[model samples]
Target: MSESNSAGMFSGRKSEGLVLVVDDEPDVRKVVRMTLEKSGYTVLEAEDGEKAIAEMKKDENSLLLSLIITDIRMPNMNGIDVINYYRKEWPSVPLIVLTGFPDMDMATSMLQHGIADYLVKPVEAEKLRSSVSKTLEKREVHGF
Candidate 1:
C-alpha cells in the first residue's frame, strides 16, 4: 500500500497531533482522512469500533490523539460503544459522531454522553473541517 493508504499511519502536519477516524466504509475513511490531512492534521483510521479501540490502545503509548471522529453503526462494534469506552478511559479526548441515520433519540443520547459534535452522512468537506476545528478549539480552551 502507498503511504497514503496505510491505516494507523500519518502523513503531513505532524505538529497538529493525531485524529482517529473510525468508519466501516473505506470510502468514508478516505474522504475524512484526506480532508483532515489537508487541514494540517494527521489522521489514523480503523475499519470498525473494535479496531479503533485496538488502535487507540496501541497508540496510547506513543501518540497523543487530539480527537476521534466515528460513524454510528458498524460491524463487530458500534460508535456508541467506542464513545462510551473513550469517555471512561480517555475522557479528555474529544469525540465527533457521523451517522447516516440521524435519529433524534440517538443524537440526544450521544450529546448527553458528551460527544463534541454530530454530522449526518454525505458531510461536506468544509463543514467537517469547521466542526473539527471548533471542537479542538473548545477542548483547548477548556484545558482538555
Candidate 2:
C-alpha cells in the first residue's frame, strides 16, 4: 500500500538492498523484479545460472547483494550449481528459491543448507515481499 511505498522511498534506512533474481522465464523475472522494486529493493535479473554467476563475480554487485532469488531449474548451470557456488564462495549471502516445480526433499535439504526460503511459484505479491524483507533483515542482523 502507500505505507510500503513511503517506507521504501522516504525511510531513513534507505533501500532494503540489491536483490538478484535468477530465472529462465522472462515473465517470471519481470514479476519478481517489479515486486521487489516496489518494496524498495534494487533488482537485477539473470536468465540463467551462468549469468548469475557472472554477475556475482563482479565486485560491485557481489558486495552489495543482500539476497538472491533463483529458480531451481535453469538452462546452462542449474540453481543447484548456483547454490553450491554461493555456499562455497559467499555463504553469508542469503538465498531464496522460487520454482513452479517443488520437491519436498530438495526443499528440506535446501532449507537445512541455510537457504532463506523456498516458495512455490506464482507467489503472492505480499508473501514475496514479506519473505524478501525478512531475509534481508535477517542478513542485516547477522552482520552480512
Local error of candidate 1 at residue 67 (angstroms): 0.3
**Residue 60 of candidate 1: its Cα lDDT?**
47
Candidate 1 residue spans exceeding 4 A from truth: 1-14, 59-63, 76-79
Which regions in candidate 2 have their CA more than 4 angstroms from the true location? 1-13, 76-79
Write the residue-wise lDDT of candidate 2 on 53-80 in tens digits.
Answer: 7876665677777888988885455556
C-alpha RMSD of candidate 2: 5.1
Q: List the residue pairs that clash in candidate 2.
A: none
lDDT string for model 1 (10-126, tens) is 444353657888888888888898888778877788887667777777734225788989887765545577687667767788889988976788888888888998889888999
Q: How close is candidate 1 to the true structure, as a TM-score?
A: 0.83
> What is the clash count of model 1?
0
